[model samples]
Target: MTLKTCSRADGHVRAFPLARTLPLLGALTLLPLTSQAADQATGEDAAGQTASYETTEQAPRSEYLSDWYNQNVTIIGSKNIRFGPQQVDDIYLEYEFFGRKGPWDLYGYIDLPKFFGTGNGADSGIFDNGSPLFAELEPRLSLNKASDMDLSLGPIKEWYLAVDYIFDWGHNSNNRQSTLYAGIGTDIDTHTPVGLSFNFYKRYQGDNYGAANEDQWDGYRAQAKYFLPLATFGNGAKLDYVGFTNYDFGSDLGDRDASRTNESVVATNVLLYSFTHLRFMAVARYFHNGGQWNDDAELNFGDGPFHVRSTGWGYYLGVGWQF
Candidate 1:
């Protein structure tokens, strides 16, 4: 049985898994971040720029040996987010960034969950001391840039040493989670309309709700991330479709081995509209055996009832300001 973190008014104890990093509008970080001038790093509208994975125009290797960065802050409202079995509503403040320098490509976001109150017992609001904070960082080293090589062959344009880092600051030390994923990644050129990239990572787990898998080598995650510019308004507003899929497997955390399952997947699709300083996003996400919990698994712990029903759909909506 899973541990219940919150007691319900109906005399049933429930588990309130902190909404781990609601990545609603953060998908823009994948739109290749608008390039800045060599001197001033101010952001501009570079949605259909050469930084796209499906970009047909290839810049010379000598051009990108310097720094280019952009940052933004957004307020997002997300619902039915399954960090664990139970879905949660999260209104969070997120800080997102993307940068490219020399051989490096980086993207990251920090989330302060429940910046607005969700009366659902998990988070009271930002002013509440019990709210959690979460973040994810991805840094990739381009092999082609590092070696000054022409690595493109057929559909593959570039290769990278990719890494993903996640940190969840829960309400207490016992509720925290820190995880690292490291492996190889590649950008694929479809030679069509969309930009695409893929990564395969091995997971290194850290502190996570005092689970049996803590501080150990756990599993693998194969992910595909892609984006497409959809439309542009006469007023300089732009629309885009950007999404990512995470397939996690190869672990002892699931099925007959544990209270959870050995595999899971989360697929998120989004629609984003951007104006000069305004951003709006809509997202639909599907989760199967989320957080490795089996949908049919039900058990009890410490005289309390614990049920695991983790498979379902989740949605997110956000309106924000991009700096």
Candidate 2:
């Protein structure tokens, strides 16, 4: 018996202008780091209320970020989207449940995806046509207040240890990769409606796409998220920005002599508007050196030079309802 592997004879490659914009982008990205350093130098504590900023966890009145719905469900749909070389219309739905009990905080969410179509020649099926019924369920546990560990310093208002587990099941299980991760998270005082967090993660991967080389992929990941308010609409309506940046230091694969191995970054900046229980979002996304899934799809199972530029940009608009 033999397997018919798809050849990259028609694969496309695009020029990455990353080198030209990196310097400017680098400066903007350093803002949080610089602020964190300055706060530490001045011994700024998140204890008392400052003139400009307050924290979600330490405020006397308990101000929850976004609306104060402890347990909520969100369903969003995106269409007429441009993602890298593909034009895709997909539907996304998610549910989040959060709670605090004793000394521990638990939060979890389930994400579901349904792909309708793709414009490019890429496969459209959940397994082939570039679209997959990709879905994930992740639960996170935080232990900071429970352990009575004073992990705060300067603008580093609070620090906690977290353990997360992600269960993936979708399509022909092409996206079936579960992950277990442990890491430390920190919160800092970045005035305005913008909040900042920097965290590090050590991840262990599970089998996927009939590949069981999960052991060869234990590595570190650095992640950050920001929340920025843009403007106010009528009544309780407001416009805001929230997104994250991530870099994964994936383990070496195949021969080490390959030109470009693994090292990828994903960043998204979103503009969101809220009106009552409904919200709308428009986001610009950037991907560098491809992410794990792209890497997996581009892997050459046969003999040939594998070339796929993982850098690209995309745009998406979505609407969601909260209950």
> Best by lDDT, which number?
1
**Which residue pairs in candidate 2 collide?**
103-146, 123-129, 123-130, 124-129, 125-129, 290-310
lDDT of 1 by residue, 1-323 (tens): 00011111010000000123233333222222222111211234545322211111354212432224555566565555565645555556666666677898777666665565543443443467643566667788999999999998789999999987776666665667778889999889998767788889999988766667778999998978776778665445667666677788997765334667788877777666665446666666677876776776676655667676567776666665544
Instruction: Candidate 1: list runs displaced more than 4 Å.
Output: 1-67, 124-131, 255-257, 299-306
Q: lDDT of model 1 at residue 251?
A: 79
Clash number by candidate, in order: 4, 6
lDDT at residue 273 of model 2 (Cα atoms): 53
| Model 1 RMSD vs true structure | 8.3
Q: TM-score for every candidate vs. truth?
A: 0.78, 0.62
Question: For residues 1-323, could you state the per-residue lDDT of candidate 2 as single tens digits?
Answer: 00000001111101000000100000111111111111111111233322122224444212323322233334333322222222333333344444344544444444333322222332243334332322222223344565677766787766757555554443345534455666887666766556786667777666434333354446667767666656553343555556667677765532342433345566666665544335455555565643333432344545654445446664444444433
The alpha-carbon lDDT assigned to residue 6 of candidate 1 equals 11
Candidate 1, position 45, lDDT: 53
RMSD of each: 8.3, 11.6
